[model samples]
Target: MNLENLRREYLKGGLHRDQLADDPIVQFERWMTQIIATNIPDPNAMTVATVDADGQPSQRIVLLKGLDQRGFVFYTNLRSRKAQDLKHNPRISLHFPWHCLERQVKVCGIAEPLSAAESLKYFVSRPRESQLAAWASQQSRPISSRSMLLQQFEAMKNKFGKGEIPLPDFWGGYRVKPQRIEFWQGGVHRLHDRFQYTRQADDSWSIERLEP
Candidate 1:
């Protein structure tokens, strides 16, 4: 397995300090807007990492449902593995792997559950089937097979019966209040550009460049 031959040069453009916004959220939205315009699939998808109480780390891809100065928001079943980990330890990390643009963003933050009102608002906006699926899936829990899961979904459909699917008691969203965020852009010769924004006590961001 001598697989060292799988590397490619990142010839994309470089990021400069002058181009960065004072607010990381603004910078993030700028990048997000660009990526969305490119029609790339699931540009809002991000990798969320959390550690259990026993110190075991886990990672999974989740959609970025909402974003603003408050933080990045995502929804899931409260019983899910990631949700359980967040319960044990609210500290969390998120990564946006926009490799097509040779850029990425990393965030370290504290995870806080979104209010029930907020969760319900977002939940109702979802497609009916997705809303039903949320009710059917136990998320991190085990299932016997696809047929059983489908049966559960079918049961939910029949129970709801063209009526509005209520938000499940165990389903909700979490917002990651970022304490530190880093934006990285690939450069020629591997001299990548990296800038980090750390939140100050005054609630302002302090930006600095780091070695590639």
Candidate 2:
């Protein structure tokens, strides 16, 4: 594989300043809607980054479950490695790269766990098998073998047996109330368009153009 040939030129999509939104959240919604309209696969997938106590960062892709003006929300086992990192350091960053659209959005904020009622509501809406699997898998834990997981899954199925599975105390959602948002659009010769919206002391947002 030739590393140099791996590059491909980006055609000017003509996405300019006039296309931007004054409110970042509204802009986000508009772009997200456009993504959906484009029929891209897994548009909700995003890379979530969290820092450990040592200030080292870790990142993984997670499905976006909810979003609003307040924050972006995602669900996972509360005791997973990511969740543990959040416990030690609430600050997190999320990135959504829609390569097909030649656009990306980066968000940074603090995370907070959702309420028990919210977790339970979402939990019950999941498929029975998924609910059982959630109960069986100790997320991020090292398992001896795949067979052990199958056995545990079967055991959980039997225990829950067509009954309402309770949302594990170790599983729930977190909302990242963004302090900063950056929108990037591809341009000619890497002179990309970058705009950032930062939250001010008075809770209003201030927008500025950034050098790519």
Best by lDDT: 1
Cα displacement (Å) at residue 16, model 1: 1.0
In Å, residue 104's CA in model 2 sits off its true spot by: 0.8
Candidate 2 error regions (>4 Å): 12-15
The CA-based lDDT of model 2 is what?
0.89
Q: Give per-model TM-scores.
A: 0.98, 0.95
Query: How well does candidate 2 match the true structure in TM-score terms?
Result: 0.95
Off by over 4 Å in 1: none
After superposing all C-alphas onto the true structure, candidate 1 shows an RMSD in angstroms of 0.8
Per-residue alpha-carbon lDDT of candidate 1 for residues 1-212, written as tens digits (9 for 90 to 100): 97898878888788999999999999999999998988999999999999998999999999999999999999999999999999989999999999899999999999999999999999999999999999999998888899999999999999999887999999999999999999999988889999999999989999999999
**Residue 179 lDDT, candidate 1, scale 0-100:** 100
> Any idea what lDDT model 1 has?
0.96
Q: What is candidate 2's lDDT per residue for 109-147, written digit by digit as tens? A: 999999999888888888888898889999999999999
* Predictions in order: lDDT: 0.96, 0.89
